[model samples]
Target chain A: MKFTILGTGSATPITERRPSAALLDLGNESILLDCGEGTQFQMLKYKVRFSRIKYILITHLHGDHFFGLIALLNTLNNTGRTEPLVLIGPHGLQDIIGVQLRYSLSFLNYTIDYRTTNPGAFEEVFSNEKISISTIPLKHRIPCTGYLISEKPALRKILAERLPPDFPLPYFKMLKEGLDVEHEGKIYANAEYTLAPASPKKVAYCSDTIFDLGIASYVYQADLLYHESTFTKELSARAQMTFHSTAEQAASIAKAAQVKQLIIGHFSSRYKDTSAFLTEAREIFQNTYLSEEGKTFRV
Target chain B: MKFTILGTGSATPITERRPSAALLDLGNESILLDCGEGTQFQMLKYKVRFSRIKYILITHLHGDHFFGLIALLNTLNNTGRTEPLVLIGPHGLQDIIGVQLRYSLSFLNYTIDYRTTNPGAFEEVFSNEKISISTIPLKHRIPCTGYLISEKPALRKILAERLPPDFPLPYFKMLKEGLDVEHEGKIYANAEYTLAPASPKKVAYCSDTIFDLGIASYVYQADLLYHESTFTKELSARAQMTFHSTAEQAASIAKAAQVKQLIIGHFSSRYKDTSAFLTEAREIFQNTYLSEEGKTFRV
Candidate 1:
């Protein structure tokens, strides 16, 4: 899976920075997270295929988190999109989208299924054959939840050289299932022909949250982790006052979780230069990266 | 007064292009016309001072025309803008803005005074000391109105050499107003001391309208004119079906109005290049230019 950061700016407005938005590409399917204002342009800038965005997860109702939704939906409708979209957010999201559509006389051609997030507890919100996703309860000014996506374990790979050249496809399935295959009256041992599957990859996205130890357990041992670092250590007091995390705080969470790599963003607009953010994060988590717009990272 | 074309793409979403939005800088005021999805980013790209945008005139309720208003308002509020903004558009515009603001839980620090547009006859909508604006009714798929802005006549230039070195600043205003200055019983005639004022400049913005002769009279002899050319002459039939205008049609209107210069944009995304649009427009209107993004045209 690959993750793309569309924007990384926080509450304050600056000419050089755009609001928050991110894209997660999982082969054929794409997911959008926290579409802030001007996200459509960010999508264009990043060459994201809007038509392939089957799932959209909104962290909260704040304008900086979900304001781009209506415009994106309108564009999808106008462009003749027919795919069904799954929207996961707080309870009032549907009402917000519905009222705007009503006033604009917009009747979308696609189906939008809204799934309400549970504010009180962490819960599994979405699951498919290839992936399972759960919510990580996050502390914020409003009801919010971060997402944890775990890719389903891959099937064991076949030792093709050890198998008969003309092995039937049906027998190969039995071998992958760790069973002895009897094909054409020939017994084939499963262990001799199959190798163990690779480990499942885990990606966790945590943003718009204060520094809390409770989140470390949910995002533990993640292959890749994205955490919001809205301020530097110098502004830790301001970060607490605003219910946001500093670079040091986010890096500490990643270190506690033992994440392989951490991507930090959602920077406050006060600092025109962001080198200080990376320097501060690296002190706590060595495998840390600063999120840049349109840059993609593999998990 | 100056106008900048921020975006010109049409209904369908294009990866490299953006939807319709323009910035009209009228001396002390910044007026936006037809703000689509990513107008805020476009404003940033064009270095427009968001705080100075006091007025917004929307041609219609189409998604590509006004979808960005809510986000723009949210950003302005978050940026701590307290200036009252005037929005002139269709009847339902206020509700569209109100619902989004309500759902997002954003109470803007600034006040937005919404005004409704009436089709068919020219009506004066905005008037200040420096400029007066009137709406010119036009034909479109929806209730659309063009805008005609006439800047106040320029003040006479005072000759510094003709005035005493120690002359008070208050008399400069009188000199600019064409008044004779009597200092210590010496009468200074206004005509002998000051040069004649420059001619008043007029700009007519005709957007999302079909080819109609009625608009020519309202925009007669304008210093500059901006007309939407969504198609070329070859696709005139398609333009009519979409209630849009061809480059030739836009030029015809500009030629009929005897406008000094013509700017044509709102090109359909089907054409990868815009040279054809300018070429077609120039055939009919000698002083026609294509409206390019971030490029400013003086009137």
Candidate 2:
């Protein structure tokens, strides 16, 4: 899996950084998270295939998180797209987009399936054969929920080179399912015929939230975790008051959750240079990295 | 008056060009016209003083014309602006922005006064000491209206060097208002003491519209006229079907209106190089120029 950071700034307009948005590519499918203002242009700049985006997960209704959605949908209609798009976000997002479309007298060329997320509890929101998605309820001034995306383990790979010549195709399926097969009184052990499957990979995204210990368990053992570090330790009081987390607080959560890697972003506009955030987060979580726009991280 | 072109592309998303938006600086006051998506960033790139913008005129409710408005207003609120903002647009704009704000549970730090424009008729929409703005009804798929901004004529310039020594302070104000002073039975001619005030400069903007000669009289004699030319003569049929205008058609309107200069923009995304649009427009109007992003035109 690959993850790309499209924006890192919070609500305030910052010239150096854009608002919050991220792209996750899970091989056969792609998901967009938190499409903030100017996100379509960011997608254009990053050369993301607009039509390939099958799902969009919005954390909240703040302008910094979901303002670009309507415009993106308009562009999709203008481009003559016919595929259905799925939108998962908090309540009121549908109304916001609906009002704009109603005013403009525009109808989408493609169908949109909107799913409103519930706050204050964890629940599975979406699932497919390849992946499953659930909510990580977060504490924010408004109703917000983070997303947890996990790729299901693939079937075991058959050792083709070691297989006997003219191996039956039916037996190949049985071996991929880790089942021993007896053909013509000859027993072929599943372990000898197939290699073990790779483990499932999970990624968690937490943003626009305060430092809540309850979130750690929901994202525990995630292969990758993206958390908002809007402020530094010096502004911890302000961060707490604004329902945002500081770098130290994000690192503490990352350490407690035992995440393999942590990426901190959603920086405040007051910060001119973000090296300090990295320096602070690295103190507690050695695998921490600062989220940079247009930079992709491998999971 | 100074006019800045922030974006020039039409409804389609083009990687090389942005959607429609423009900034007009009328000396003491500034007005933003047609704030398309990504306009806030364009303002930041152009170093436009957000505080100086007291008025915003939206041509239509199309996504390409006014999608960035809500985000811009949100950013203004986040920046702690306390000045009232005036928004002039179609009937549904207020509700569109109002719904988004309500859903986000955000209230503006500054008050917004919405003015709805009347379609199919010319009417004055805004007037202040510095300038007066009116609507030029245009033909589009949606209910759209163009804008005509005219800077009020300045006070007559007094010939201070030619004035009599120790001129009465009260008479100075009269001289500035084009009145002569009679001192001790000697008549002082007003023309000798003051120069005539410069003519008020006018600019007209018409975008996302079809070729309609009825709009010519409303924008007649404008110092600068910005018209959408989404296609060339070769694709006039397509332009007509799409409710857009060809470059040659826009030039015809400029010539018919006797405008001093014509700027053709809102080019279709199909055309990669825009030199053809300028070439086509200048064939009928010699003073024609293509509207370029970030470029400023003086009137």
Candidate 3:
């Protein structure tokens, strides 16, 4: 799986940086997270295939998080996208988009399935054969929810060299399921011919929230964790008042959750340079990295 | 008066060009016209002072014409603007922006006075000491109205050298108003001491509209006329079907209106090069020019 960071700035309109948006590409599907005001332009600049996006996950209704959604949908319709799309967000998002479309007299050529997420507790919001999505309830001035996406574990691989030359196709399924099979009065042990399946990969995204230790358990053991570090430790008081996290706080959460890698972003417009955030986060979590626009991270 | 072209592309999202938006700067005040998606970013790129923009005129409710308005207003609020703003548009614009703000729980620090326009008739919508704005009814797929901004004529210049050395201070006002004054039984002619005031400068903007001859009278004798040229003459049939005008058609209207100069923009995404549009327009109107993003024209 791979993830691309489209924008990293927060509420304010800063010339140097854009607003919040990210793109996640799993092996079988692609999803967009937190489309901000210029997310469509960023996608165009980054050359993202709009039709390949099957799902869009919005964290909140703030202008910096979901303002670009309506335009993106309109562009998709104008470009002749006929595939079904899923939109998962908090309550009121549907109404916001509905009113805009109604006033503009625009209708989509594709189908949109709207799913409202619960911001009070963790719950599975979406699931498919390849991946599952769950909410990580967050603390903010307004109702907000983060997302946890996990790829489903695949079946074991069969070792061709150890198997018989004329192995029956019916027995191969049993071997992949780690079950011993008996064919023609001969027993074949599953361990001897099959390799162990790899563990499932998980990615957690938490943004626009204050420092909350309660969310660590929900994101525990995630392969990758993207947290908002809107300010530095020097402005911790301001961060608390605004319900935004500092770099140190984000690192502490990542360390406590034992995440493999931590990505910090949503830098405040007051910050001219982000090296201070990286320097502060790396002190607590060695695997911490800063989210850069148009940069992709592999998991 | 100076006019800045912020975006030149049509509805479709293209990497080479942006959607429709423009900025007009009169001597005492500045106004934004048709804020499309990413218009705020374009303003930042062009270094327009957000505080100086006291009025915003939206031509229609199409996504490409006014999608960026809410975000721009939110940013202005976030940046701590306390001055009142005027927004003039169609009937449904206030409701559209109101719902988005309600969902996000965002309130502006400044007061927004919304003025709704009638698309079927010409009427004056805004008037101040510096300029007056009127609607140029347009034909489009949706209810749309273009804007005609005309600067009020300035006071006539006083020729101090032609006046008496001990000219009365109370009579200065009369001289500026081009009124003859009798001082000590001597009649001073108004024409001898006062120069004629320059003619009022006028600018008309018509976008996302079809080729209609009825709009020519409203924009007659305008110093600068900006009309949407979405296609070349080769695709005139497609332009007509889409309710848009071709380059030649826009030039015809400009020539018929006796406008001093014509600026054509809102080029379709299908066009990779715009030289053909200029070439087609100049055949009918020699003073025709193409609107380039970030370029400013003087009237």
Candidate 4:
């Protein structure tokens, strides 16, 4: 699994930084999280293909979190995308988009499947054969939820090179399921021809949330985690008042959750230098790293 | 008067070209016309001080014509601008912005003076000491109007070199207004001391309007005129159906109005090359020029 940070800045628009947006590439699918005002431009700049994104997860109704959605949807329709796209967000999202589209007299050329998320509690929202995604209830100024995406366990690997020519394909399925195969009185044990598949990688995204230990269990033991750190420890009161988290608070949550790696971003524009954030986060969580725009990390 | 083309592309959003937006700089004041999506970023990129922009004239309700207004206003408020902004557009414009802001729970820190324009009629809406702005009726898919910005007659010129040493400063105002000065038995004639002021320039902005001869009277003898040419002559029928104009039609309007110079833009994104637009427009009007982004033309 790969995660690309498209933008890491907060509500304020700036030349050097953009608002919140991220891309998750989970081999079989691509998911966009929190598309801000210029997320489409950022995607174009990063060479992120628009058609590849199958799902969009919005955290809240704030303009900085979801303002670019309409433009992105319009561009997708203009580019002739017929693929069914799924949008999972809090209640009122569909109405917001519907009103704007109606006001502009825009008719989408493509289909959009929208799923309203439950904003009050953590629940499993989406799942497919390859991955399972759930939400973590987060405390924010508005109704919001964080996402937890986990890659499902892979099937047993098959050794095609060692197999005889023109082997029955039905036998391969049995072997992949870790079962013994019998073809024309030839019995093949699964252990003799197949190797165990690698363990599934898990990633949890906890963005735009305050420091709350109550939800740590949902993100515990994650292979990789992204959390918002909008300010430094010096502004803890401000962070609490704004329903945001400081670097130290985010790192403390990561340490308590025992996550393998922590990626922190969503910095306030008041901060010109972010090295202090890194230094502060690293004090509590040694595996903490700053999420820079256009930077990608593999899990 | 100076006009800066921020964006000129039509309908579709493009990486190389933007939609429709223009900045009219009238020395002390700046007026934004037709703010397309991402226009605020364009303004920031071009070093346009948002604080100086007191008036915003929206031509139509099309997404490309006014999508950026709310975001720009939000940014302005976030930047702590308390100056009242004047937004002039159709009737529904205020409600569109009001609903969006209410949904997002965003209240502007500054005041916005809303001015709704009447469709399908020429009306003088704004006037000050230096300029008078009137709306010219135009045909479009929605209620739309073009703007005729006329600079008021120049004040009397001040001759600094002709002023006597230690001349009374209060007499300077009378001299600038072309009044004769009578002080200490000295008869200072207005004609002998000062030269004539330069002629005031007039510019007409025709944004997202269909081909119509009625606009000629409003734009007659304009120093500079900007007209939307969404397509060339070959697609004239399609342009009409979409309530748009062709390059030839725009040129014809300029020719009929006897405008000093015609600036044509808002080209359809289907054509990669824009040379055909200039070639076709110039065939009907010799003083036609294509609008290019970031280019400033003095009138």
**Docking level of model 2:** medium
TM-score against truth, every candidate: 0.87, 0.95, 0.96, 0.86
Candidate 4's TM-score: 0.86
Residue A42 lDDT (model 3): 92
Q: How well is candidate 2 docked (DockQ)?
A: 0.72
Ten contiguous residues minimizing lDDT sum, candidate 3 chain A: A23-32
Name the Cα RMSD for model 2. 2.1
Q: Candidate 1, residues B1-299: lDDT per residue as tens digits?
A: 78888887877657666778888897677889888877887888778989889998887777778777777888788778999998888777887777667655669898988878886769988888888878989888777888888888878999989888988888889989989998878898999889988788888888888888778899999998988999999999988887889999999989999999999988887989999998889899989998788889987
In model 1, which runs have C-alpha deviations exceeding 4 angstroms?
A: A158-193, B13-16, B119-121, B152-199
Could you give candidate 4's per-residue lDDT for residues A133-169 as a string of tens digits? 7888999978889998888888999988878888899
CAPRI grade of model 1: acceptable
Worst 10 residues of 3 chain B by lDDT: B22-31
Name the best candidate (by TM-score).
3
Alpha carbon lDDT of each predicted model: 0.86, 0.91, 0.92, 0.87
Models sorted by lDDT, best on top:
3, 2, 4, 1
Per residue, candidate 4 scores C-alpha lDDT tens digits across B236-299 of 9999999899999999999999999999999998988999999999999999988899899988
Backbone clashes (count) for model 2: 0
**Each model's DockQ score:** 0.41, 0.72, 0.77, 0.39
What residue pairs clash in candidate 2, if any at all? none
